[model samples]
Target: MSYFGGQPTNPFGAPTPKPPILKRQVPPLPENLDMATLADIRCSVNIFSPATGEIIEVVVGVEKRKFHVHDQILRSGSAFFKTALSKEWKEGKTRVVLLPDDAASLVDRYVQWLYTGKVGVTLDNGKTDYATLAGLYCLGEKLMHDAFQDRIVDALVSGTREPNNNAGHPTTCSFPMKDVVDDIYKGTPKGSPARRFMVDMHVMQGTSGWIDVERPESVNHEFAVDLAFAMMQERAVTGETKTKHAELNRGIPCSYHKHGKDGVCGGKA
Candidate 1:
């Protein structure tokens, strides 16, 4: 039967969307009254090397250190844990997983992000940050952390596309140092989005020739091959060619120095 004008209401039957869970509760709930499902809880897990009993191992040159981490947080966001922590696996039985090859600091940040959804990488001037992001992206790919991978990609793109970063034209921006680019190409797979984006950035900056001539020694051979292939594909489909008369503006800082003080080279004068 119609309630008011002739239309019936179904407020009780209509599904209501649930609100997102807040990271922290505001004003705190009363301690005396408690709900089993609404309380903050901690479940600890061991992530250790089988022999060392260390959660995370970091190696620098010849020195190594270990870390301790929680289980719920690590398991929440990483697919690598799904199988690694399964009942049949030895890691599941012992509550430990070995990561001897990974950098400790990067793994630390990844664990923190698993808990807080925030990566603690600093981007003060954006110079070293690219390498950090590239490394994190590689780690994310290795760990099958899709969300973290996307986050790193967003950071990389935004840093390069910063308003003052355009040099002169909006279509142009900065690139990473030779070492950082090399690390990215070396760790990432061919046709990775991050790698492809970097290639596209070099091309879009009208710096395709810049890659060929200016400091070609700095470029990695494999990366150069990938860039060439990407450029060829870009040309074949769009018929766009590299700019023959592109200017090499010495006024702007190179990829290594733009993140330095006053946008100067960080390593050299």
Candidate 2:
């Protein structure tokens, strides 16, 4: 229950999504912080470091949870875009330490596991727990790499739009739907990078199962396929041409296209 203008109302209004409170292993600590750190985090850079070199290095400190770590320096070997983005504003090419707080949260999740040698993510009680869950999702993605993040995102976004269902995304998948939806609605438009960054959807499993990092290969593929298939099916069902997919299952065509050459239509037309 959240107090909106002094009135207690459902955090998730009509949809009544699974609450972040329910997922909490520890109740909201007024500001329960789970800190993280990254050290020598090196990723590949184009034309900056021999087509691959040091991208960022960071060390995080969380006053609570006794979580502290100095990760093995990170380095990338041949990559284009860099996600280790920073606002420090250096000359030409520079290292990015400490991702934004929200992004760093993910790094903490990974380091915490490596340090304690323990999987901290567990559904301890029947409260909508966002903090712990969010941390776990971030950690899992960080450690496991893009596959993990992609899997989680696909699962979370399943049924969120047309592509999800077409890809065989299951309804049982757990990804923070409510929080993400709230974040999207509450966040500023695309222009507002700050607000966009603040809107982290690492937690929101809606009417889905628990957000566990088990079986990534199966889960992600199934979800992606479901999303793709569902999207194609939706297009056909709606008699939409030229455009192979629709947005949000609302029969609205997207201006752009993606995926392999086949994509939504699969060149059947």
Best model per TM-score: 1
Candidate-wise lDDT, in order: 0.54, 0.31
Lowest lDDT 10-residue stretch of candidate 1: 1-10
Query: Which digits, one per residue and each the tens of the lDDT, describe model 2 over residues 50-82?
Result: 112232344344422322222121222101112
Off by over 4 Å in 2: 1-73, 76-96, 103-106, 113-118, 126-144, 147-175, 181-232, 235-269
Give model 1's TM-score versus the native structure: 0.58
Off by over 4 Å in 1: 1-64, 126-128, 163-173, 206-218, 236-269
TM-scores of the models, in the order given: 0.58, 0.28
lDDT of 1 by residue, 1-269 (tens): 00000111112333223234444433222222123312222212221111111232222212344444544434444577656777798877777677777786677556544433444344555332777778888887777666667777777776665544425565545556566677788788877887777777766664544554767677788778877887777774222322321222343335434474456555565
